[model samples]
Target: MDHDQINNQSRGAEGKDTKADGAAVAPQFSRDAVFPGEVVGEVTDLNRQDLEKQKAAQGSAHFHRLGWKRLTVVLIVEAIALGSLSLPAAFATLGMVPGVILCISLGLIAIYTSDVVGQVKLKFPHVSHYADAGQLMMGRFGYELVGAMFALQLTFLVSSHTLTGAIAFGNITNNGACSIVFAVVSAIILLILAIPPSFAEVAILGYIDFVSIILAIGITMIATGINKDSITTAPWSAWPQDGLTFAEAFIAITNIVFAYSFAICQFSFMDEMHTPSDYKKSIWALGLIEIFIYTLTGALIYAFVGQEVQSPALLSAGHTISKVAFGVGLPVIFISGSINTTVVGRYIHGRMYKDSIIRFINTKMGWITWLTLITVITVLAFIIAEAIPFFSELLSISSSLFISGFTFYFPAMMWFMLIREGSPFATHNLWKTALNGLCFVIGMIVLVCGTYASIVEIAHKFKTGAISSPFTCAALA
Candidate 1:
């Protein structure tokens, strides 16, 4: 079947049509399809303008704008943004050895799943977002469920970024303003930046963010190394007595996985690339660089700071240098997060404006609608950030609840569901079947176990004296 026919058939509201037997089936989208004006087919001249508009809306019309260099910078920034945030604390809590092992392991898993996403996208060019992928697998219902969950996941991630920004601001300002106020300030700033549509614009900020993340991490490492004496505790001492349980340990592991949490953005990134073929290379570059950085940063900081390492890690650096690190981090504090905000906005705008009369590019109403939607999302995320103000625990909850599925299971499921289409019992499909199935199962475990553990611990922190009331200035730094 051709692409449009597949989309039409999948728009049914109920379950997908199975064969006479019980096996699942997939849409007949080709994997190795090339660019526009290629051998895939021809476009009708009657609707040529509409087709171009559709291509622009879908992000393929601006392909050559983001070459391999720009995309690589974007991927690098995305991968390392949050990775530098919380991994040291994980290493501190889990002990250097186990924590490093888990960090590298999750990085490898991320690489494999990320590669899976690239493969799936190469096969199905229509999948510009996770929602599109779900639709291909299960029609309208699939798109609704996946889109909701995917948006929810990205929303929480944006909230996490906002919360982190609030903490960063609070750290610098020393509670001159309440954390809630800082969160709102950060949100408003993000709202303005996100108003201009298109990943191409954000990719420019991404280039700036790339430098910020690197400098921030590098300076933090230097300050920590030079002032190791200030940390009071030895670098590699087993802090079993600092009071962490196995559940908390697992939560730490999840946070490390959270550091590699850019999988959710891969489809959006690929969709905007000048040549989608360059994406696999970008994925490998991001995966390897992040693994090295996560391992090195986590081990080095935890070694020097020990249990003193904070979530942002900037806090535990030598006093003057901590300030410098935080200042350097300010770019990513807004822009890396703008990346998430941009992705979420694109998903919503794509859905609302795709086929509607309001989608007309020449209309002022379309621009107004787009700006209004982005503002609302940014505010809603701001509110959530203040409500769940605990930075580390919030990261844990977001990762366990959503990141596991997007970063691991969804890609695996996509591969398994589409690779063989309806041929479940084919001998040729057996090895792929086992691998994808196993990864899917692992994703589920991460979701279930990690969620339960994070929630329980977050509650315990609230009940005990460990955490303050939500929406407080309370020195979250």
Candidate 2:
């Protein structure tokens, strides 16, 4: 599964630039793997064979190319996309005290688990994706298991964005167009924007997505803050009202977790860094930013709007603010969806083509193949988005089924397995072992209980007709 074995259709112009000759060259493969299962290209300092060193010498611009700033923006956008929107509603459901506590606590836990991923990569520099980490611990089965889980997680994420993007469109248009039309429109946009061959190529556009969300939320905050007098809000009730249940609250908790469920991405990000040491800086920077944003945004919005605050919290605004905010947020929903789609696409492209990705990137047929995958993925996401339009329910189910594994379970396994591998003869460190065990148990609880809660909630929504049916003209707005 090396470059030579793949269809090197454009093999003649091996080392030349496609633009210089106006012909796609055979990719001069790079030794710098951006994590094996994830998107790749950059050069690495690590030693390999002489052949690889030659390949590294000739790699294109896309490989191992990200610096700390670009990496930070990418990570922040991924975390902030769909998950950050629900924090206000989470606060409303769990009360300000518990909600803030969860926001800080979970954000910290997410950082710790992210650090665990970094450590795992440090130990096994070749590890590329979640499956690569899994394979290190349990061979082929582990690789497939973890790989499929993450692929599914990314797919679920893309679908969630599709649903949310359509909602955002509806929210902006006052439900003028059918949501299904918006979904298709959003899907087309994602496919076109995701044409870049690697995440590194997309890094430059990260700021646009980030700005879109900031303006969107900032507008909502300003609009709501100005009209505080008219807003009706509940006193912080210690528990749910008679009709609303704790299941609803946990779903909110799951939403916050969903916001921080970024462990699955650490591998890909780390692989692209020019200096691996900068990764610690990236994680800490991300954690601090999220803590401030999540707590402040959630508390302020919830305090003003109280228990009736919508999941996105944007929707709880006055009609004008809601429309303006969602319209402003347009780039984020689409950008975030495209990023996730590319992550899924990268994993598949790497698996199918292995080390031949650079060659794939250099060919016209390769771009066609990539576009085809993107089109197919968007179609799938569209169908799912239409079928389950409830935002919180979709987030919760994704969280329960995969978030825990991505953020907690996989990291703990990496920690424990790495420790044992480094010191096979030494007695296991009791305190470290206990801590990892605790993390694993917590992850399992969230996965099992949270999944049951989300499914039950989705079922209830269906039975009560609280959500729209597939392809309906009814406003999901």
Candidate 3:
């Protein structure tokens, strides 16, 4: 029988009010009836499409309408929120020369990982579904692990942002209001962000872009001029002491990469775009611009602020104006980005647990669960920040560990699986096996060394009186 005859018979099988027992029946017109060869054609087309999509998705390509200006704005927001805040620490760990080089190199890596490889994953429908990347790269177990990791990361990140928000609010008011204001304001922000509003509704995104850049640039100028004058009379030029080695420097660089690169989140966001193909070009452009910004900021901080300062001005004691900018700026980026990240994390987690006894874990529950988890995490962040002298250090170390596992380790393993499953056919680049393996190996080294360094520093601080909570802030002082 022809394809039309088969479809007509299938439609008639549902008892559509058609009077043809021998002849082909014209089924009642419904939305799905416009296409005649619906069932088999759909199944065949979907499978073929998915197969092609999987290949492209694994490449981490993406498509969209984001032009240079919009991309730059996004990078500026990210730079201020995540990169600029950590510039001082990077300089402290790597020194002026190595630190500048490391920042440039890692910034490039971050760009490639996020814009290039991550974009491929973002372009195709269903293929780029955050957890599906795990499945594609690994298998069922990989999917579960990615889901769990994402859930934890979101919980911790949201909490950290809330803490930052509370602290910023406290700075503005200066009445030690980080506690009450932190919880209430952060919860409200999360609620607003979690509703999945369009880019138009994300007014804070623009605020974040404007405020972060202004603050960073303003502080760089003031701090440079002031610190330069102070350091000029001192005559100590031999790379201010930090007591770090080559291996330590290498691990430091790795940690910086983990800090700057959020490719996993970038890949997952592909679903939000109307066109995924924009990824290949846009990501490269975004990465290049971000790298320049990050490199310049790091170099400026190192050259002006010197290694002796405890933290970045933004992190430490910014001028009243800069402080105000940072105080408000950090929270806007935090809540806005975290809400979207949480939504993705929850969706992945719900799917993983959907078939278990906890079958009620749908999208609605995902949001609720994510919100509750975020609230708890936020409280912990406040307590930790309040009590621990080295809380930022600990947070950075933990974040690195999280990225190492989720971004570096799991993806590497999955790519290996792809090789095993279909050799050259499954993954176009046979070299990925070697490249991914190297990343996994290097990641493991960073994980072990960085974690140990963090623990040791925490122990030292505890022996003294630097911090009250070891777990809350033990990375280093």
* Model 2 stretches with alpha carbons more than 4 Å out: 1-61, 237-244, 355-360, 387-395, 420-431
Task: Residues 1-477, candidate 2: write the lDDT tens digits.
Answer: 355633352243343447665776444554555334221342333323443544544443455787877777888767777457678877877778888888898898889889888888887888767788889889999989888888877877788777777788887777888778887888888877777756677777789988887887788777767766677565445444556576786787787877887678878777767777678888888888888888888888777776777778787778888888888888888887788888788777768767663334555555677778877877887777777557557767777978888987778887877744444334666656766777788799889889988888989988998875657877765
lDDT of 1 at 177: 82
Candidate 3 residue-wise lDDT, 1-477, digit = tens: 556865776575556444566554543443443244444333344444554455445322322333434444443443335345566556666766766676676666455345434433543356544566676666798677776666556555655565556555555655444355554565456555644322222334645555655565556546555656564333222353556765455445654565564555554444445555665565676566656666676666556655643343454334465455555465455644454444454465446554432222223454466556545544554455455556656765776676776546655664555323456334656665566666677568667777767676666667787664433321222
Which 10 consecutive positions of candidate 1 have the poorest summed lDDT?
Answer: 34-43
lDDT of each: 0.75, 0.75, 0.53
Clashes (backbone N, CA, C under 3 Å), per candidate, total 2, 5, 19
Instruction: Candidate 1: list runs displaced more than 4 Å.
Output: 1-60, 237-244, 356-363, 388-395, 421-431, 465-467
Question: Least lDDT summed over 10 consecutive residues: which range in candidate 3?
Answer: 468-477
Cα lDDT of model 1 by residue, 184-252, tens digit? 878877777776566666778876888898899999888888888867375565544376786887778
> After TM-score superposition, what is the CA distance of residue 417 in candidate 1 from its true location, in Å?
0.8
All candidates in order of TM-score, best leading: 2, 1, 3
Full-model lDDT, candidate 3: 0.53
The candidate scoring highest on lDDT is 2
**Superposing every Cα of model 3 onto the true structure, what RMSD results?**
9.2
Compare candidates 2 and 3 on TM-score and give the better one: 2
